[model samples]
Target chain A: MILLSLLGISILVALIMAFIGDWRFAPEVNIGGSLLTFIVSLVLALQVYHEGGSISGSTYFFVDYLNISLVVLTTLVSTTTAVFSRRYMRVEREHGRVGHWRMRFYHAMFQLFIFAMLIALVTNNFGVLWISMELATLATVLLVSLYRTPTAIEAAWKYFILCGVGIAQALFGTVLLYFAAERVLGAGGNALLWTNLSRVCAQLDPTVMRLAFVFLMVGYGTKAGLVPLHNWLPDAHSEGPTPVSAVLSGLLLNIALYALIRCKALVDGSLGSGFAGNIMMGFGLFSLLTAAFSMLRQKDIKRLFAYSSIEHMGIATFAFGLGGPIATFGGVLHMIVHSLAKSATFFSVGHAAQMHGTQEMAHIRGLIRGNPAVGWGMFLGVMALAGMPPFGIFTSEFLILTATMKDAPYLAPLLLLGLTVAFAALFRKVQPMVAGLIPSGQKQLSAANIPVFLHLALVLILGIYLPGFLANWFHLAVEILK
Target chain B: MAHTLAAQINSLLAALILLSAFALLAQRKIMGLVHIFAWQGFFLALSTAVIGFASGEHHLYISSLLTLGMKVFLLPYILYSLVHKLKIHRDIEAVVNIPTTMLLGIVLVVFSYHLTAPIRELSNLMTRSTLAVALATVMLGLLMMVTRRHAVTQILGFLAMENGLFFAATSATYGMPMVVELGVALDLLIAAFIFGIFFFHINTTFDSLDVDQMAKLKETD
Candidate 1:
C-alpha cells in the first residue's frame, strides 16, 4: 500500500505540476513534493528494515533491500536539486534565459522524470523496468534541451539518439531474456517478473542467458555511462542546466547501475559463472582510466565534473564487478556517497556558474574572494570528489582499493594511477577558480548554500561514522546481491 | 499443415522485413525511407498476426494490431507530416557512402545470425526461424544511425530498430505481457512526438537538420 502511494504521489505531483508549473511557487511545490517523497521513502525503508526482507507489494512493484536505499538517495538528491534549482532557475528567469512556459515544462518534466526513475527502481517486471528507463530518458531529454540553444539542442539530440539506440539493445536483451524464461516459467506475465525469474534462475538455459546478458550489459551499460558508451554523459551533463546535471550524475546513473546489477545477479545465478562480472570489470577499469585522462582537457567545469562522475561510476562498477561481500559493500557505499558528493558538487558548480554568468573555468576565477560560501563549497565538494579524507568518498574508495588489492592485486596499480591522475586534474582546474583575483564587477549573489553544506555534512558524518543501521543495511544488501 | 503454413508466411514476412531494413540503408530519398519503414512495419504486423494465429496466443493479436496502428499508420503519418512541414524531403547525405554502408549492413546481418545461432537451436517455437532476421534488422537499424547524418533518417533508423525488437519478442516468445506491450507502444508514440518537437527545435537553431553542422561543443584547447 505504501509503495503504491509513493508512486501515486509522484504521478499526482507530476500531473499537478503540469498544470501549475508556471506559477511563482512551482519551485516550492517541486521541493515539497520531493521532500514528501523522501519522507515516505524513509518510511518505506523503515518498513523494509523492520521486516528484514523483500516486500512484494504486488506483482507490479516491490521493495527490496537493494532498491530501498537507492529510492531514498534519489528522493533526497532530487529534493536538494529542487531547492537549488528554485534559486538558480529564478536567476535564469531574471536574466531572461528562460520563459514561463519552459519553466512550466521544466517543473512538470522534473517530477515526471523522478516518477519514471522511481518506477524503474521498484517495478517487478523487466519490461516495465525497460519502459520506465526509456521514459526517464524522454523526460530528461526535454529538460536537457530546456534552453533550446543550438548546443543544448545538439546535446539533447545526441542524448536522445545515443540512449535511444542503446536502450533498444536493452529491449532486445529483455526479449531474449523473456525467451529464455518462457520455456521454464511456461509463458505468461510471470516470465517477465524479476521475482519469479530469480527464483528459477538456475533452471534457465545457460547459453541463452549468456547471450541475453551480453545485450543487457551493452544496453544498461550505455545508460550507466560506462566507457565507449559514455560519449553522451559529458555532453548531456555539460549542456543541460546544472540541476539536471546534478541529478543525471547523482541519481540517474545510479538507477541504471541498479538495473545492471539486478540483471547481473540473475545472469550469475543462471550461468553459475563469472562471465558478467568479468565484463563489468573490464568496462569499469577502462572507463575509470579514460575519464581520468579526459578530465585533464576539460574547460567547462560541469564537463570536468561530468568526467569525474564517469570515473566514480567506473569505480563503483568495478567494485561491484569484483563481486565479493567486501567489494559489494564498498560498491553500495560508493553509490551512496557518490550521489551525495557529486550532487553537492554540482549544486556548488551551479551557483558558481550562475554568479559568473559563464561555466568557463578560466573566466570563473576568485570564487572564494567573491563568495566565500560557494567558493568553499566548491573546494570542499571537489575535495570530497577527489577522494580526500574526512569524506565518505575516502571511506568508500579505501574499501574499494583494499578489496582490489586483496582480490586482484594486479589491477590495484592501474586503479591508483587513475585516482591520482584525476585528483591532480581536478586540483589543477579548481585551485585558480576558487582563489584567484576576483573578476571586475563580480558581486555577491544570495546563494542557497544550505543544501550544499547539508549534503557535505552528511558525507562528513558518514565518513567519520557509518551508523549501525546504515552499515547493517549495506550488509544486508551485499548478502542479497551475492 | 496449418502450423507449417503459418511458419512459411512468418518466414516470408521476416525476409521482407530484412529486405526493407536493407532498403532503408540504401535509400537516400527521405520520402522513400519513410515509406519503406511503413512497409517494414506492415511486414512485422503480418508476421506477428500469423504467429498469434498459429500459436493461439490471443494476446499477440492485440500486439499485432498495435504494430499495425502505431508503426504502419500512426508513426509513418507523423514522420511524413514532419518531413513535409520541415521541407526536408530531399536526398539525405550519408556520413559514409551508401555502398560502404550496405556492405557494413551485410556484415552486421552475418554477425547477428552467428550470434543468435545458439539461441535458435534452443528455441522450439515455430517463429524461431525468424530470430536471426529480426536481430539483423536491429543491427541494420543501428547501422543506419551510424551512417546517416540526417536527424530524420536517424529517427527512422531508431523506429526500425524498435520494429526489430517487437519482431524478436513475437518470434522468440509470442509477445511480452499485455501491459508491457502497451507501455512500450505508448513510449514509442511519445518518442515520436518528442522527435517531432526536436526536429523543429533543431531546424530553428541550426537552420538545417544536418547534425554535423552543430559542432559548437568540444574541448577548447
Candidate 2:
C-alpha cells in the first residue's frame, strides 16, 4: 500500500506542480516534493528486508537486492542534483540564458526522468523495462538539448543516435530472448517475465541464448559507456547543464550497467558463467585502457572527469567480470562510491565552471585561491576517484585487485596499469586548475556548495567504514552480479 | 511447379533489395536518397509479404504493414518536408568516392552472407535465406553513415539501418510482437521529428547541415 502511495504521491506532486506553474515558486515546490520522494524512497529501501527473500506485489514492481540499491542511489543523487539545480537554474534565469517557460519544463521533465528510472528499476517484465529505458532516452535527450545552443543540440542528437542504436540493439536482444524463452514455455506474454525466463533457462536453446547475450551486451554496453561506444559520453557531459551531467555520469550509467548485470545473471544461471565474464573482462579492460589514455588528452575540465567516469565504470565492469564473491562485492561498492564521488565532483565543478567563466582547463587558474570550498571539493573528489587511501574507492579497488590476483592473476597488472595511468593523467590536468594563480574575471561563488560537501562526506565515512547492514547486502547482491 | 514458384519469388525478392541498394549507393540528392529509401522500404515490405505468403506465418503480415506505414509512406514524407523546409535540395557528395563505396558495399554483402549462412541454417524460417540480405542492408546503412556528408543523409542511413534490423527480425523469427512493432514504429516517428528539428537548428546555427564541418567544434585537437 505504501509503495503504491509513494508512486501516487510523486505523480500527484508533479501534476500539481505542472498545473500551478507559478513562475517564482517552481523550484521550491519541486525541491520540496523531491525531498519528500527521497524520504519515501529511504523508507522503501528499509522495507526491503534481505532475510525475507524479497518482497513483490502481483504487479511488475518489486524490490530486489539489485534494484533497491539502484533506487536508493538514484534518489539520493537526484535529490542532490535537484538542490544544485535550484541554484544553477536561478543563475541561468538571472543571466537570461533560460526564461521562465523552459525552466518549468526542465523541472517537470527532471521529475519524470527520475520516475521513469525508478519504474525501470522495479519492472519485472522485459518489455516494460525497454519502454522505461526508452522513456529515459527521450527525457534525457530533451534535457541535453535544453540550452538551444548549436553545440548542445548537436550533442543531444549524437547522444540520441548512440543511445538509440544501443537500445534498439537491446530491443533485438530482448526479442531474441523472448523467442528463445517462448519455445521452451510454448508461447505468449509471460515469456518476457524475468522469473519465468530464469526458471526455464536450462531448457532453452543454447544457440539463441548465445546470440541473445551478444546483442544484450552490445546494446547495454553502448549505454554503459564501454570504450569504442563512449563517444557520446564526454560531449553530452560538457554541453549540458552540470547537474544533468552529474546525474548522467553518476546515476543513468549505473542503471544501464544494472540492466546488463540482470541479463548477465540470467545468462550465467544458464551457461555457467565463463563466456559472459570473459567478454565483460575483455570489454572492461579495453574501456579502462582507452578511457585512461583518453583522459591524458582532455582539454575541458568536466570532459576530463567524464572520461574518468568511463574509466571507473570500466573498473567496476572488470570487477563484476572477475565474478568471485570478493570481486562482485567490490564492484557494487565501487558503484556506490563512484556515484557519490562523481556527482559531488560535478556539483563542485559546475560552480567552479560558473565562477571561472569557462570549462577550458587552460583558462581557469588557481581554483584554491579563488574559492576554497569548491576547490577543495574538486581536490577531495579527484583524490577519491584516484583510488587513494581513506576513501571508499581505494578499499573497493583493493578488494577487486586482490580477488583478481587470486582467481585471474594474469589480468591483475592490466587492472593496476589502467588505474595508475588514469591517476597520473587526472592529476596532471587537475594541478593547474586547482593550485595555480587565480585567474581574472572570477565571478562570485553562487551555486549551493552544500550538496557537494554532503556527498563527499558520505563517501568519506564509507571509505573509512561501511555500515554492517549495507556491507552484508552488497555481499548478497554480489552473487547475482556474477 | 510449386518449388519453381517459391524459388522464383525468393530470387525476385533478392533482386529487388539489391537493386534498391544499388540505387541508394548511387543516389546523391537528399531528396533522391529519401525516395530510394522509401523504395527500399517498398521492397522490404514486398519481400516480407511474399515470405509470409510462401511460409504461411500470419505475423509477417503485420510486420509488412508496419514496414509500409512507418517506412515507405511516413518516414519519406517526413524527410522530404524536413529537407524542403530546410531548403537543402542539392546533391550531397560522398566523403568516399562512389565507386569505392559501391565496392565496399559489395564486400559487405559477401561478408554478411558468410556470417549469416550458419545462423540461417539453424532457423526453420524459409525467409532464412534472406538473412544475408538483411545483414547486408545493415552494413550498407552503416557505410552510408560513414560516406555521407549531409545530416539528412545520416538520418537516412539510420532509418535504413532500422529497415535492415526489421528485416532480420521478420525473416529470422516471423516478426516481433504487434505491441513491440507498434512501439518501434512510434519511436521511429518521434525520433525523426526530433532529428528534423535538430537539423533546422543545426542549419541555422552553422549555416549548413554538413556534419563533418561541425568537427571544428571538437575541444581537443
Candidate 3:
C-alpha cells in the first residue's frame, strides 16, 4: 500500500503541476512531493531490513533486498536534486534564460521522469520495465532539449535515435525471452513475469535465451552508458541542465544497470555457461579504458564529470562481471558511493559554472578565491571520486580491485591502469582550477551549498563506518545476484 | 490439401514483403520512399491476417488491424504532412549508392536465412518458413537506416524495422501478448509524434534536414 501511494502521489502531483501553469508554486509542489517520496522510500528500506526478505504487493509490485536498496538510493538522490534545482532554476530564471512556461515544463517533466524510474524499479513484469524505461527516456529527452539550442537539439536527437534503436533490440530480445519461457510456462501473464520466469529459468531454451541475452545486453547497455553504445551519454549529460545531468549520472545510469542485472540473472540461470559474464567483462574493460583516456581531452566541466561517470559505471560493470560474492558486494557498494559523490560534484559544478559565467574549464580559474565553498566542495567530491582514502568510493574501489586480483590477476593490471590514468587526469585538471590565481573579472555569487555538503558528509560517513543495516543489505543483494 | 495451400500463400506473402523491403532501398525520391513504405505495411498487414486466420490465433487478428491502422493509414499520413511542412526536397539523400544498398540487402537476406536455418529445422509452426524473411527485413531496415543521410529516411527505416519485428513475433511465437502489442503500437504513435516535432526543430535550427549539418557538438581539445 505504501509503494502504491508513492507511485500514485508522484504521478498525481506531476499531472497537477503540468496543468497548474503557475511557476511560483511548482517548485514547492516538486520539492514537497519528492520529500514525501523519499521518506516513504526510507520506510520501505527499513521494512525490508527488519523483515529480511522480499515483500510482495500484488502481482505488479514487489520489493526485495536487491531493489529496495536501489529504491532508497534513487529517492535520496531525487530528493536532493529537487532541493538543488530550487536554487539552481531560480538563478536560471533571474538571468531570463528560463521563463515561467519553461519552469513549469521542467517541474512537470522532472516529476514524470522520477515516476518512470520508480515504475521501472517496482514492476514485476519485464514488459512493463521496458515500457517504463522508454517513458524515462522520452521524459529525459524533453528535459535535455529544454534549452532548445542547436547543440541541445542535436544532443537530444542523437540520444533519441541511438537509444531508440538500442531499446528496440531490447524489445525483440524480450519477445524472444517470452518465447523461451512460453514453451515451459505456457502463454499468459505468468510467462512474462520476472518472479515466474526466474523460477523456471533453468528450463528455458538455451539457444533462444543466448540470442535474447545478446540483444538485452546491447539494448540495456546503451542506456547504462557502456561504451561502443555510449555515444550519446557525454553529449546528453553536458547539454542538459546541471541538475538533470546529476540525475542522469547519479540515478538514471544506475537504474539502467539495475535493469541489465535483472536480465543477467535470468540469462545466467538459463545458460550456466558463463558467456554472459565474459561478454560483460569485455565491455566493461573497454568502456573503462575508453572513458579514462577520453577524460584527458575534456574542456567542458560537465563533460569531464560525465566521462568520469562512464569510467565508474565501467568499474561497476566489471566488478559484477567478475561474479564472486566479494565482487558483487563491491559492485553494489560502488554504485551507492558513486551516486552520492557524482551528484555532489555536479551540484558544485553547477554553481561554479554560474559563478565563472562559463562552462569552459580554462576560464574558470581560482575557484577557491572567487568562492571557497564551491571550490572546496568540488575538490572534495573529485577526491572521493578519485578513490582517495577516508571516502566511500575508495573503499568500494579497493574492494573491487582486490577481488579482481584474486580472481583474474591479468585483468587487475588493466583496472589499475585505467584508475591511475583517470585519477591523474582529474587531479591535473582540478588542481589549477581550485588553487590558481583568481581569473580576471570574476564575481562571487552566493549560492546554496546544503545539498552538496549533505551528500559529501554522507559519503564521508560511509567511508569511515558503513552502517550494519546497509552492509547487510549489500550482502543480501550480492547473494540475490549469484 | 488445406495445409499445403495455406503454406503456399504464406510463402508468397512473405516474398512480397521481402520485395517491398528491397524496393524501399532502391527508391531515390522521398515521396516514392513513403509510397513504398505504405505498400510494405499493406503487405505486412495482409501477411499477418493470413497467418492469424490459418493458425486460428484470435489475438493476431487484432494485431493485424493495429498494423493496418497505424502503419498503413496513420504514420504514413503523418510523415506525408511532415515532409510537406518541412518543404523537403524530392531527392532522398543516400550515404551509399542505390546498387550497393540493394546488394547489401540481398546479402543480408542470405545471411538471415543461414542464421535461421537451425531454428527453422527445430520449429513445426506453419509460419516457420517465413522466419528468415522476417529477420532479413529487419536487417534490411537497419541497412537502410545506416545508408540514409536524411532524417525522414532514417525515421522511415526505423518504422520499417518495427514492422519487421512485429512480423517476426507473429511468425516465431504467434505474436507477443496482446497487451504488449497494444503498448508497442501506442509507443510507435508517440514516437512518430515526437519525431515530427523534432524534424521541425532540426530544420529551423540547422536550416537543413540533413543530419550531417547538425554535427556541431564534437569533442573539443
Candidate 4:
C-alpha cells in the first residue's frame, strides 16, 4: 500500500504541476511530493526490515532487501534534488535562461522521472522493467536538452541514439531469457517473472542465459555509463541543467546498475558460472582506467565530475563483479555513498557555476575565497569522492580494495593504480579552483548550500560511525544479492 | 500438405523481408529508403499473419495488425512529412560504399544462421527457419545505420532494425505478450515523434540533416 501510494502521489503531483504554469508553487509541489514519497518509502523500508525484506505483491511489485535499500536511497536523493532545484532553477529563470513554461515542464518531468525509476525498482517483471527504463530515458532526454542549445541538442541526440540502441539489445536479451525460462517454468507471464525464474533457474538453458547476459550487460551498461559505451556521459552531463546532471550521475546510473545486478542474479542462479562476473570485472576495470585518464584532461568542471561518476560506478561494478559477501557489501555501500557525494559535489558546482557565470575550470577561481560555504562544500564533497579519510567513500573504497587484495591479489594493484590516478587528476584540477585567490566580481553565495552540507554531513556520520540498523540492513541486502 | 504449404509461404515472406533490407542498403534516395522500410514492414506483417494462421496463435494476428499500423502506415507517414519539410529529396550518400555493405550483409546472414543453428534445432515451431532471416535483417539494419550519414536514413535503419526484432520475436516465441506488444507500439510512435522533433532542430542548427556535421561538438585538436 505504501509503495502504491508513493507512485500515485508522484504521478498526481506531476500531473497537477503540469497545468499550473506557476513557478512559485512548482517547487512546493515537487518537494512536497518527493518528501511524502520519501517518508512513505522510509515506512516501507521499516516494514521490510521487520518483515524480513522479501515480499512480492501479486505479479508486478517485488520488494526485497536489495530493492528496499535502493528505494530508500533513490527517494532520499530525489527529495534533496527537488530542494536544490527549487533554488537553482529559480535563478535560471531570473537570468532568462529558463522561461516559466520550461520551468513547468522541468518540474513535471522531474516528478515523472522519479516515478518511472521507482516503477523500475519495484517491478518484478523484466518486461515492465525495460519499459520503465525507457520511460526514464525519454524523461531525461527532454531534461538534457532543456536548454535547447545546439550543443545540448547534440548531447541529447547522442544520448538517445546510443542508449536507445543499447536498450534494444537488452530487449533482445530479455527475450532470450524468456525463451530459456519458458522451457523450465513454462510459458505466459510466469516465464518472465524474476522470482519464478530465479526459483527454477538451475534448470534453465545455460547457453541461452549466457547470450542474454551479454546483451543485458551491454544494454544496461550503456545506461550505467560504463566505458566504450560511455561516450555520451560527459556531454550529457556537461550540457544539461546541473540538477539533472546530479540525478544522471547519482540516481539514474545507479538504477541502471541495479537493473544489471538483478539480471546478474538470475543469470548466476541459472548457470552457476562465473562468466557474468568476469565480463563485469573486465568492463569495470576498463571504465575505471578510461575515466581516470579522461578526467585528467577535462576543461569543464561538470564534465570532470561526470567522469568521476563513471569512475566511481566502475569501482562499484568491479566490487560487485568480485561477488563475495564483503565485496557485495562494499559495492552497495559505495553506490549509496557515491550518489550522496557526487550529487553534493554537483550541488556546490552548480552554485559555483552560476556565481562565476561559466562551467569552464580555468575561469572559476578560489571558490572558497569567493564564497566560503560553496567552496568548503566542494572541498569536502571532493575529498569524500576521492576517498579521503573520515568519509563514507573512504570506508567503502577501503572495504572493496581489501576484498580485492584478499581474493585476487594481482588485481588489487590495478585497482589501486586507477584510484590513485583519478585521485591525482581530480585534486590537480580542483585544488587550484578552491584554494587560489578569489576572482573579482563573483556573486554572493546562494542559500542552496543546505543539500550539499546535509549530504556531506551524512557521509561524515557514515564514515565515522555507521548506524547499527543500516549496517545490518546492508549486510542483509548483500546476502540477498550473493 | 497444409503444413508444407505454410512453411513454404513463411519462407517466401521471410525472403521478401530480407530482400527489402538489402534494397534499403542499396537505395540512394532518402525517399527510397522510406519506401523500402515500409516494404520490409509489409513483408514482416505478412509473415506474422501467415505464422499466426499456421500455428493458431491468435495473439499474433493482433501483433501483425499492430506492426502494420505502426511501421507501415504511421511511421512512414511521419518520416515522409519530415523529409518533405526538410526538403532533402537528394540522394543519400553512404559512409561505406554500397557493394561493401551488401557483401557485409550477406556475411551477417550466414553468421546469423550459424549462430541460431542450435536454437533452431531445439525449437519445433513452424517458423523456426525464419529466425536466421530475422537476425540477418536486424544486422543489416544496424549496418545501414553505420553506413548512412543522413539523419533520416539513420532513423529508417533504426525502424528497420525494430521490424527485424518484431519478426524475431514472432518466429522464435510466437510474439511477446499482448500487453508488451501494445507497449512497444506506443514506444515506437513516441520515438518517431521525438525523432521528428530532433530532425527539425538538427536542420535548423546546422542547416543540414547530415549527422557527420554533429562531430563539431567534440573538441577540435
TM-score, candidate 1, is 0.99
Going through the candidates in order, the fraction of native interface contacts each one reproduces equals 0.84, 0.19, 0.46, 0.21
lDDT of all the models against the reference? 0.92, 0.80, 0.87, 0.87
Rank the candidate models, highest DockQ first. Answer: 1, 3, 4, 2
- Pairwise DockQ winner, candidates 2 and 3: 3
Task: After superposing candidate 3 on the true structure, give the runs of residues whose Cα lies further than 4 Å from its correct spot.
Answer: B1-4, B89-91, B94-96
Mind giving the per-residue lDDT tens digits that candidate 4 earns over A25-140?
Answer: 77877888899999999998888988986877668788888888888889999999999998898888888898878888888888889998999999888887888888888888
Candidate 3 C-alpha lDDT tens digits along A326-359: 8889888889999999999999999889888788
Model 1: residues with Cα > 4 Å off, grouped in runs = B90-96
Best-performing candidate as measured by DockQ: 1
lDDT of 4 by residue, B1-221 (tens): 77789889999999999999999999988888888888888988888998889888898898988888888898888888878878886656654578988999999999989877877877778888888898788888888877888888888888888888788888888887666677677777777877888898889988888888887467421
For each candidate, what TM-score against the reference? 0.99, 0.92, 0.97, 0.97
TM-score ranking from best candidate downward:
1, 4, 3, 2
- In the range A139-206, model 2's lDDT, one tens digit per residue, is 78878888888788778878887787777678767766776776777555567777677677777666
Worst 10 residues of 4 chain B by lDDT: B212-221
TM-score of 2: 0.92
Residue B97's lDDT within candidate 3 is 72
Off by over 4 Å in 4: B94-96, B219-221
TM-score winner: 1
Which candidate, 2 or 3, has the higher TM-score? Answer: 3
Give the Cα error of residue A90 in candidate 1, in Å: 0.5
